[model samples]
Structure formats: structure tokens, C-alpha cells
Target: MMGGELKRMDLTMCTTTHDPAPLSVEECERARLARDPAYDGRFFTCVQTTGIYCRPICPARPPKPENVTYCTTAAAAELSGYRPCLRCRPETAPFSPAWNGSQTTVARALRLIEDGALDGPGASVDGLADRLGVGARQLSRLFRKHAGATPLQVARTVRVQRAKRLLDDTDLSMTEIADQAGFGSLRRFNTVFAEVYHRPPSDYRNRKRKGRGSPTGHRALNPEPLRV
Candidate 1:
């Protein structure tokens, strides 16, 4: 009886290990090199030269194999000290399956976040839960488990992207941009943008132009806040 129990346990462990989730580092590199959109949400790739990481389908030229490192999540990469890519906008990329792999509630929460639900004035977990037909506590649990970011962190990231887009694309005043980008104030917007992107909005815009006049005398697209 003891022997049979031990065999069953070993078999169960083997099955569990063999049936593990689909996460591929080599596959991620192949997808990055191929610029395959199918794997965009599945993995992130970091370029050693730039210190910035991007989704697999980014339009920028592919880095050499020796120059790339695969990252499982944007947060993981950020935690490892990589900055988000200006070209790919990892924040705006589709939510990872890991975020929704276990719970429908967390998945929906992420979708809502992408839609700018939590960005504007007075957005709250209670209101977010009411819309999702779930409780605040449950929503928090999902964010903690999958996103590696609190609900507020997710929302704030989205807002920063919005601000960055405005800063780079339009000559909007900081105050106007802040309001349109869903920030409570220009100070907050500037602070957050500087923190995440490592440059003030003005500095980012200048660097993007590099003192060259715009081709059409109009601002260039940031390409970072791609919504489509």
C-alpha cells in the first residue's frame, strides 16, 4: 500500500511538472526577431544596448541575438531596472495571460484599466468593482496575484503613457496636457512622467527632436502610447 501511494505521488508530480504553463525564452527571442504579433502579449524582449525593453511585435529593427534578453513580464523587467521602450509602449500592450490565467475577475479588471477607467477624477476600487460585478477586496487580490502592481499602480502607468503621448505629439500646455491625460495636476503628471520615463516631458520632447525641425513643422508621434 505504501509503495503504491508513493508511486501515485511521483506520477502526479511528474504530470504537474510536464503540464506546466507555456513560457518560452528562446521562443520569445524568435518571435522578437520575426516581429511576430502573435506573441506580442506573450513575452517582452530587452535590448542590452538601449536599456529599454519592448514587446515582441515592436516595429523597431530587431536586435542581434547576442544583444537581446527575454523578460517574462514588463514589471519583471522594470524590477530588473529596465525602462519601458518608447517605440513599443509595453504598458499599452495586451494584458498577459498570466494576468488572467487563473481568474476572470482579474482579466476584466485589466481590460477596464486599459480603457482608462481608473485614470480620471474620483476613480475608485469600489466603483471599479461595481462595474465588474465583483467586490473591491477580490479585485485587489487579482491585481496582487497577476499584475505585480496594485490597481492604482496600473492606473497610474496608463495615465503616464497618456501624458507622454501628449507631450511628444502636441504643443499643449502642461496644464492642458495634464488634464487631458487624466492627471489630477500638472505637478503630478510631470513627476510621474519623469520617474517612469527618466526624463521630464520637455526633455523627452527635445531629445526626440534632437534640435532638428519637424519634417512637416508638426510634432512627431511618440509611438509609445499606441492605442490601436
Candidate 2:
């Protein structure tokens, strides 16, 4: 196939295919109740009492049917003002298929964002675009289409997930944790952590025992700049 034709074929393959109708709330509720990992990135479940949203694979008990709202994307849940659940690390769920198999600029941007491409030292959307050999604006448009989030928003999601992992698994100081988590500053880290997780990092860590499981078996925390 010609390059242009090949590109078109690739794009078509990556596009989401589904019935025009929405998945019934009942079906999503059943998926949530089952804690189905396969549905993790494909949908989000919101709890009425906590006002927090989680991926379908969240280990928390399923909420009553009357108390749940299903979302098609994490960005949709965030736009609706729902905070993410720390326990499930929804942001770490597998990337949308739109991102995984598509050959468009947006798909590449989504992959880079998952790798924390827009943050840490020497990282920017322009840098990402350069690496992908596309203009930054084109990259942004692709991200918005497939991810329902700007490039920056996608990057923030990745950072939040990294922060959550550090918060849950380590006793590292906040500043150290922030640095390791790819935040530019302790203040910025705190702000985003609270915004996404609905609590300060320290507060979340302090809620449970300092050490829940084995430490030595895990790698020691490293502050080196992360590529993803």
C-alpha cells in the first residue's frame, strides 16, 4: 500500500468501534461488581457517598446500584469533578485502544504521556513532538480527540499515578517523593496530589500503618529523573 493509504488503514483500525448507544448503567454496574480488570481503562465508576471515581478493577467493594454513575473515560470523570481513588491507581490501567494501535499523532502523544514525557528534566511537548517528528499542535489535537484530555492533562494523570505509588509504598520524605515522582517542585506536587487524590500525600500515607508489607524485596527509592 502507498504510505498515505497505509496511514488511513492504520487510523481506521485504531478508531473505537461500538454501537451508537451507550452501555446501560446496569451493565457497567455489573462489571464494577465483578471487579473486571478487562474493563479498567474502558470505563469508570463513581461512588455516590465518597464522590470519588475508580476503575472497574478497583478492589473496594462495589457500591449500591443507586449510588453509582458510570463514565466512559477518566477525563470525563475528572471533568465531572470526581476525584480518583488512590487504591486502584486508575491512571495506571492499560492505555485506551485508541492510543495503543492507532498510527495518528494523538496515539503517539498518548503513549508519550503515559511515559511521563512532558515532565521531568528535559521534557516538553515540543520535545515529545520532535521525538515523534510531528508538530506540537498536531500532537495536542490528536491527544484531545482520543484521550478527551490535552497533552498536559494526560501528563498530569501519569504524574498523579506515580505519586500515588510512592505515597502508598514508601516512607520517603515529601520533597524527596515529589522529586522522584517527576514534579518540578514540592508545592506543585502537593497541589496536584490534593486535586487528583483529594488529600495531601502525607495525610494519605499517615492513614495506614507505615509499613504494610515487605520492604527489602522491593527496590530502594531512586530520585533519578524518570523517562516515563
Candidate 3:
């Protein structure tokens, strides 16, 4: 998935400063139109019309050039008010090579977040920053500069995406899905899922099942399962 190739490129090539540089509109457009694998994860294309972001290699029909905008990172796209594309599933896209090199602190923080550092007991911004040997304020600033989202927002996205995967790929109940996906409580899970996807988690799961065959060979449960 070009993840390996991205790692091999010089990290310095990804950004010249602490903040990532914006992708060239012309080049990003070409890559989006071509569905170029080389450019996948290098930048995300946010469709203004749909309010969804996708990887360059997404198989969905490309939006008109005027309706497309590019973000240096998926986090940036999400922060810019775009949801991950249902067709392309931006979460499954390869990690941006730049993430590996340009900013090590942000990268390390992201790895920890993905591992659920922020999901349970003792998971505070101050705690995470201390683990990384930096102050909370500095860590927050760095996250905003590099990832385009606060550490909490990034962590929430990770949790929400995990919950989505479980919903799509398994018959897990909402409570089970919430726990397995690192949401401490169903109430919090439902709130965050609604904020991100503009629907209840159960609604999303039902819609996905109707559009694509159930992955686990069983009918999806009703939205009633989501009630606390």
C-alpha cells in the first residue's frame, strides 16, 4: 500500500518546518483524478459538496476539481469539518510517510493514542504529555500545528473509527463494541459517533449492513440496541 515506500523517502522531504506545508492544488488534483497509489496517504482530498474526505486512490468517482480541497493529513481534513468517506474509508488508508519523520513527538503521540492511551484510567492530556517528556501545553500546540487536531480529538477519532470497524465487520452489540473500541461508556461512544457521522452508531451500522451484506452472516440488530 505504498506504506513501505513512504517510509523510505527522506522525512525532511515531507515538511520544511514544524507545520506541514499545504499540498499543491494542481498536483493534488492530478493525483486525485489519476487515483495514483504513490500519492495515497500523502494527502487527503476533501470534497466540499459532500463534506467527506478520501484518499487519492479511493475508487469512488472523483468530485469536480472545484469541489475538491486537499489536506496535509487526515486529521486536518477531519478538523476542517469533513467526515471520512464511507465509500473509501479514509481510516484504512496508509499512514502518511511524513508522519513518520517530520514530527517525531506528534508521531509518537499518535501511536500511543491508537493504542488506547487516552481511553481509560489515567488518560489525561497532562499524563500523555508527561509520558512523552513534554508539557501538556507544548504537546497540545504541536498536535495542532502538525496533526491539525487536538490530542483529544485525534484520540476520539481513533476510537470512533475502531467502533465503526467493529460495527461493519462483526455482530458485536453496541455495549460490547464501545468497550472493545476503547470508549469508556456507551453514552460517550454514542455522543462522539453522532458528532462525527451525524447519526447514531446503530443507524450507521444498519445502513452499512443494508448497503453491503453483513460481514458476520447475521442480520444487524435494530437501533434500539444503542439505548443506554
Candidate 4:
């Protein structure tokens, strides 16, 4: 073990070696220099010179290793007050954790939601936080720092994405889609889906399977919440 036990990364405060232990510094640096897509989302390259962070595959000119610091997540970098790269959009990086350590709060919350923690009419942020052993307010703060959305907003995005998939690949009706997507009512679903994607839910029904994305070519879930 290179350092001590892992703990919550208080990225909202500071970035230093004394903060929670990070991934292998040597490995993160090598991957950044290589411009390796394989390392994308595993870690981020935070440049002190530019006060910006980027994906490993970011096409912009690479910063000197001395001017760079590695962060395990976009939220960490952002919470530490670094902006996300305009070209790479670290928020949208594909996630694939290379370490076998504890999952970050974001990762765990996402896992729980994917496993149906946020499903059904009874699901709520307080319930999810209880499962994660954190308070609702704290969990929401973590999400907003890292995810650029509140826990409910994250769940709403998940529902909309699920509904979009159902619309594209399945023959489900509007009511069915709303119910399956975990909205309290079909009317609520329509209103939220339109607000987020700027299109009514029915507008996407039976849509072609090709090039599935928003007008900006980003996924409906992330919605270009670029924290730049």
C-alpha cells in the first residue's frame, strides 16, 4: 500500500497529498502523457496552470506533468474549484474504475439507483441517503458538487433516460413509459422530460435508432451540465 486507508475525498476544500490517498500518482501521470482513452474516467488530469481538468483522451495540448495533479473524479476537481475542459467535457467521460477500493459516493449512489433504489412511487432522496449512511442534505451536496445536480435531479435524469430507451427500442405507450420510468404521474413525466430535453415525450416516440442524442450530441442523462 502506497498510503494509508481510503476516506472520503473532501475535494470541495483542498487538493493535497495530505487529503485522502489518491490513485497511483506515477500511473496517473503516465496515462495522461500517453493520452490514453483507456484511462478516461478512471482519473482526471487537473492542470494548475489553467485551473482546468480534462479527460485522459482530451485532445488539447497536454500540460506539463509538474503543473498537473490527478483527481479521481470530475466532481473532485470541480469541488476543488477547477473548471472542466471545454473540449473534453470531463463530466461526460465514460466511467470505468481501475481501482478495487471503496466506491466513491457518486459511484455508490449511481449503483444503487441502477439497482432500483430510486424506482417506484415511494423512492426518495432521504431513503437513498439512508441506504448510503449519509444525510439527505449531505448527499445532495456531494451530488451537486460532482454531478452538477441534486439527488432528485439525478433520479429524474435516470428516469428520463430510461423512458427514452423504452420509447426507442420498445413499443410502450406514454402512460406505460412514465410508469416504467418511475414518475408519479404521466403528466409529471411529460412536463419534466420536456423541460430537460426541450421536447415533449411524445415527440420522441418511435424515433429512429440512429444517432441517439440531444441537439448538442450529449446523452439525455448528463444534459451538458458542463461546469465550465
Specify the highest-lDDT model's number.
3
TM-score against truth, every candidate = 0.47, 0.46, 0.49, 0.45
Residues 81-144, model 2: lDDT tens digits: 6788988866555665433543466676777777677878789888988888878887777666
Using lDDT as the measure, name the better of candidate 1 and candidate 2. Answer: 1
Candidate 1 pairs with clashing backbones: none
**Tens digits of lDDT, candidate 1, 46-147:** 677777878888998888776666655677667766788888788666565533444777777888887878767788878998898877887788779877
Looking at model 3, residue 208 earns an lDDT score of 71
- RMSD in angstroms, candidate 4? 18.9
Model 3 Cα lDDT, one tens digit per residue, 31-69: 789998877777777787878889898999888876776
Q: Which RMSD values do the candidates have, in order? A: 21.1, 21.9, 20.6, 18.9
How many backbone overlaps does candidate 4 show?
Answer: 0
Q: How high a TM-score does candidate 4 get?
A: 0.45
Q: Which sections of candidate 1 miss by over 4 Å?
A: 1-102, 211-228
Ranking by TM-score: 3, 1, 2, 4
Candidate 3 lDDT:
0.77
In terms of lDDT, the poorest run of 10 residues in model 1 is: 1-10
Error of 1 at 112 (Å): 1.5
